[model samples]
Target: MMDRTDRHCRYFLRQISARTLLYTEMVTSQAILHGDLEKLLGFTPEESLIALQVGGDDPARLAKCATIAAEFGYDEINLNVGCPSQRVQSGNFGACLMMEPERVADCVAAMRSASNLPVTVKHRIGVDDHDHYEHLRQFVEIVAAAGCQRFTVHARKAWLKGLSPKENRDVPPLRYADVYRLKQEFPDLVIEINGGILTLDATLEHLAQVDAVMIGRAAYDNPYLLAEADRRIFREAVAVRSRHEIVEAMYPYID
Candidate 1:
């Protein structure tokens, strides 16, 4: 979701579904440590229930960033291990970390110790030839032991060698069953499924197997789909907003 789920995009989505948890784009630990803190981390109070996603391999730097995110009022601190971009691979983080579960566990442990807020992780099912359920289970088991309770699994394996980030997202056939099996084995863990979940009905179907479902590209492209989220997902007894009402609501901000 890098460069996609910015403040403006999140604000627009928030207007559609007040109850869906919003996450910030993956901010690198280097940016959090050296960049403008306000510009990188700031958000309106209206964007509450937001999780700040950070990308890095260094435990100390990640811990510092997590502390800063907590101070900046993020409800959750999420570690990103799903990104497959070459830029991310060069940094020795992202999907490549799937091969090093102990290191990821250390990063998670450090962040949890540094921040009082909930610490979570977003990762892919596998990487390259390691697309097996046991591999993913082991990765989760090691990380979960480090006080990390929640995991968001993108139900696709990452191809680190040949595919581009965009290609990795589409070419790798989605194996949602792997995610569902992960939840069955680790019933104590909060497993949320991601990747290719386009509609609310599809999301609800995934939710039947996992604890939650995350909609990324679909949500951003067809944001109005979230208009019914409050009623359908949260079970709120509220009226759904019309597309016209939503546009009207954004007028003041747009102007």
Candidate 2:
């Protein structure tokens, strides 16, 4: 959920399910460390199962951001290592951080020390010209050692210098095999595969090999996909409602 961290996306997704979890966009450490604290952490506690996504390389600053996020009642705090935007890469965060596993571990450790809620990471398999499964394994090893067990990996390599953010997401092919290999190696870790996942069947198929599957664009473009998640994924049956009924219900909130 990259830009879905925005208020509109958050509200829209919330309307999809009262059960499915939601994540905020990647807010950098500088914004939380130096910018307005309230605006950075401010969110309705009861809105949904909200998680805060913080982007940065500084351990202390990430820890501070985690503390603020937890205090604001975020269900969890996640570190972003998957974004491939030039603006993010130039700032020394996002996918580029995959090259510095030890630093990522340090940041995760610091965040863990600051909050009781679960600390997780969202990253890419590898970055730029160096695309190797071993690189991702080493990163998982180092960060897991820091007590960060939950991870979400966009199943692709990020071309930091040659691609725009949108291009980075589309141009690079998603390699689910690399991510599944990670799960095979670290059976103890909870791994979620992202990128190019568009349908419940796809997500469910991947879930057979990994701990979870995160759908981004598909979930947003066709939100009704999630309307059935509670029943299909969680195995909790929700009373069936017609599409017209759903639309009529949304009328009150449309304005």
Candidate 3:
């Protein structure tokens, strides 16, 4: 959600569902450390239940980024290990890091210790020929041991060799069963499944098997999909606001 879930988009979504958790586009740890912090990390208090997602391989820089994120009032810090973009791969992070569980462990531990905030990881099930249950389990165990209790898995193995990033999202068959099995084995950890989930009903169905569901393109493509999220997903009794009211509400923010 690099350019998709920006502050403006989040504010729009907030007017729809106050309870839905939102995340920032992945900001590089180096960017947070040296770039314009406000532009990179700024968000409104109204955007509660929000998380800051960072991408990088340096444990020290990520740890620093975590501390900065906490000070900026983010509810969670998410490490990206699921993205298959060539840009991310060249940086030595993203889906490629699945091959280095211990290194991921070190980065997680460093971030956790730095901010003392809730740390989560988003990763694919596997990479290259390493797509196996044991491979996923080992990766999860190592990171979990480093105190990352929550993992958002993009239920597909990332093919780093031939597939382009766009193809990656569609090419690799979604092995949701693999994610379901993960939740079964590690019942104590929070396992949230991602990848192609498009409806509130589908989200609810996945919740029956896992702890949570993360919707990306689906939600962004048709944000009205979130209008009933509070009442339907969170079970809040608040009245559902109409589309006209939402559009009127967003006019000022859009300006």
Candidate 4:
């Protein structure tokens, strides 16, 4: 979701579903700490219930970014430990950090201390050869111990060595069962499953197993699928807008 869920894309998704919580692209801690703040973090008020995802392993910088996110009115701050791109690994963050649970814990703890907003972690189930349920459980427990209550688990293992980022998404077989078992073990934790969730039916089905379902690529590519989200997921009594009406609403922004 790094390049895909930018401000404009979020706005478009917002037009389709008013209730589904949206997340911004993964902005690294260094960017928020050193780069132009507004350019990196700015968003309109309409994008409420949006969470800002930050990528980094430095506790202090991550804390600063989380504070900035809180000041900018983000509903939550999510730490990204799921991305498998080489650029991310080079920074000692992303899925690579799964090997260093204590460091991730420190980062989460620092962010929690810096901001009153909810601090969450988005991570893959496992990484490379360590694709076991026990490994994932330990990772989740350690990070959750740092007061990160919510975890969005991408249901795939990341091969940091050979596969490209796109291949990592496709090649690593998604083991959604591991995520479900995580929920079963840590019943108190808020576990949301991500990866390969396409249709509304699949989302609803996953919801039965976990607290939430995160739709990534499918949500961006065939965005119209989210049109039914409010009524079907949230069960809101409000009338759903037609696709044409949604496009009309977006015209001003496009102009």
Candidate 5:
């Protein structure tokens, strides 16, 4: 969802579902700290309830990024511990951070201290040899103890060595059961499941067991799939927009 969920893509999807919580693509703490501030953190007030997902292993820098996100009016701050790319691993962040849950906890605690926005973590179920439910559970507990109340868990383990980032997304089998069980045990926390959920019916099915479902590439690939999301997912009575109407609606923004 890197290049896929940029500002233009998110703006287009926003026309489809006014109520769904749209997410910005992962922007590393380094980028937010040193790169173009407005380009990295800016969004219209129309994009309310949106979350800015940041990547990094540095507690101080992530805390600074969290403060910026709050000043920029992001409703939530998400720490990315799910990308399995070599660049991410070399940077000592992303999926590699999952192995060091205590560090993830420290980063979470630091961010929460710096801002009032909700601090959350999006992580893989497991990684490489740590692909077991107990390890996943332990990782969640340690991080949750640090005050991360919501977690968007990708239901696959990451292979830091064997696969390309694109292949890593598909080749690893999704173990949604691990996510469901995480909810069962930690019923108090908000557990949103992500990975391979492509259809509304599939979304409903996951919602039966988990608190929420996150559709990434599936929603981005055919954004219209969320045309009825406000009605179906949020129980709003809004009419679904037709393809033509949706495009026409986007004209002003395109200008």
Candidate 6:
């Protein structure tokens, strides 16, 4: 769970599923390097599987922050190259970074070399008006060659100048077909699809086409949906817990 604005949500979620992976809201590299590192990423270890989502174009700063995240005991480190926020764009990161695959590759390589934990990337298909399957293919190709194998693609293009971040997630149409094709082209790579995947059925459908499905809004809104997620998708032997029971189970730990 990343990009969420509420700390209450994180506390509630940690109460629900200790086995599920969790992510912090995207923190810029400058925040980690120049700002307060302890305050930005501080959390309890019992918050389940945690990953830090970083935003920045500078490779050295990004790597240094990744090392800090590792020292903070983050299970994995993810780079956010998919956000369409104008503020993020002005910072020369986010969706705009997708236009520079070589730079993204270098950023990933630096992060990977800095820490022992897994380095992953979450990106958009394309940015602004440059929406094309080939463009996404090239971006993935170069990044994969740079030693970052895990990718989560938001199946949409980001119109940098027009859409607001909220509108970017909704207004622009989602193009899931391109993501499926990318998976077919790079079967060796671990490909996960994001954007507009709301229901368990939708995730199932996408999983048939890609290696994994990443849920954001849906997972946060209808959290009960995850009741069936682990058993069905991850093939865990544990039975799905009722949402009410999940809450109760987590209450004691959080208290």
Residue range 118-161, candidate 2, lDDT tens digits: 99999998987678888889999999999998999999899888
Worst 10 residues of 2 by lDDT: 39-48
Per-residue lDDT of candidate 1, residues 1-255 (tens digit): 888998888888888899999999999999999999999899988787799999999999999998999899999999999999999999999999999999999999999899898999999999999978899999999999998899999999999989999999899989999999989999999999999989999988888999998999998899998999999998999899998888888887778
TM-score of 1: 0.98
- Identify the runs in model 2 with alpha carbons over 4 angstroms from their true place: 240-255
Largest lDDT belongs to which candidate? 3
Q: Which residue ranges in model 3 land beyond 4 Å of their true spot? A: none
Return the TM-score for each candidate structure.
0.98, 0.93, 0.98, 0.98, 0.99, 0.93
List clash counts for every candidate, in order.
0, 1, 0, 0, 0, 0
Per-residue lDDT of candidate 5, residues 1-255 (tens digit): 688777777788888889989889899988998899889878887766699999999999999999999999999999999999999999999999989999999999999999999999999999999889999999999999999999999999999998999998899998999999999999999999999999999999999999999998888778999998899999998899999999998999989
Model 1, CA-based lDDT:
0.93
Could you give the C-alpha RMSD of every candidate to the true structure, in order shown?
0.9, 1.8, 0.9, 0.8, 0.7, 1.8
Q: What stretches of model 1 exceed 4 Å from their correct place? A: none
**Over 4 Å off, model 4:** none
Candidate 5: global Cα-lDDT? 0.93
lDDT of 5 at 207: 96
User: Candidate 2 or 5, higher lDDT?
Assistant: 5
> What would you estimate as the lDDT of candidate 3?
0.94
The TM-score that candidate 3 achieves is 0.98
The Cα local distance difference test for each model comes to 0.93, 0.85, 0.94, 0.93, 0.93, 0.85
Model 2 residue 25 CA deviation (Å) reads 1.2
Q: Residue 67, candidate 4: how far off, in angstroms?
A: 0.8
